[model samples]
Target: MTTEHTGTPRPSDAELARIAAELRALGEPEFDAELEATPVASLVRELAVPTAFALAFGPTDSALPAGAADPAGAGGLLDVAPLTELDRARVWRKIVARRSGGAAQHHGPRAPSWRATWVAVATAAGLALVPVLSTPDRAATPAGRAAAEALGSQARAALEGVPGEQDGGRAAELAAQYSARLSSSGSEAPR
Candidate 1:
């Protein structure tokens, strides 16, 4: 059975011309005499392809060859312009601009956020560890000495009655052994 026509309103002549212009802007590389005569040229206007979608497909032309069918007198409907190097460049520029709000052109490559974060973290870590990793023999300032004393006091408070209160002698023995090892290894741990 033949399918019934829905009689959907076709795109207006202006709309068709605009579509043709868009196709011309994005068509293939060249629209020579021989290429236009091919079925591909007619198919393009009939299809009303958008520039970005078919830009890679190469150029086409709407110029009907000798004895070609002239169903509609609208020249724009048959017109498929060829894409020149400059035209291709322009289309590409438009595409890129559309995608990135033209920022890619003004700004080159961007440093990744994670890389910047890592750099900041590394700098902070280096600064924080500098004092602890300084040469041990250097004389401490009053503030430095006070800070060191406070840290030592905190450590003593934490370990005040460590293994002594925990178990009879096992923890004390372990602590004693650990202390002896620390005293034996004279070089301070690296930062």
Candidate 2:
């Protein structure tokens, strides 16, 4: 039977359940053949790329801050004028004020809590770790090994990434060396 175009609306849950029951009534077909045609791996690959980008940079609508007047998201990103800069600074100042003990005054003082102390310590530790984890040195591949890799080595790059099983002490040493160099050079360090 030919089905008419019904304004392109999705089928209701009840309709979907009825259709599913009917499909089940017909003895099991080879799902393997249908799955091979539209493999789950290919489906995941199609969806995962978009999902990763979304998680990394957030949605297009979210690129703009809340209470922004623009509906079309027009003009260049930098064209938001002084509003963007001031808004960012305003948000950052509030974050600093709240984290510092200013929020306690607003909410009225209470006994010092260990949970807040633990959270503050954890946050500080995570922030300290960011710089160390951001830039990683690629393990020095042996000179002989470089030629093999350059000329199509059989070794595939692992999903877990380049396995640099270095001791944590080595990372600490690198950080110390970098800090010493900065102190000696008097670069004033980056903002």
> What is the lDDT of every predicted structure here?
0.47, 0.38
RMSD of each: 18.3, 32.9
114 Cα displacement, candidate 2 (Å): 3.0
Best by lDDT: 1
Using Cα atoms with residue i matched to residue i, what is each candidate's TM-score against the true structure?
0.18, 0.17
lDDT by residue (69-99, candidate 1, tens digit) is 3355334433534344554454445434443
lDDT of 2 by residue, 37-59 (tens): 22121211111123333444453
Candidate 1 clash total?
A: 7
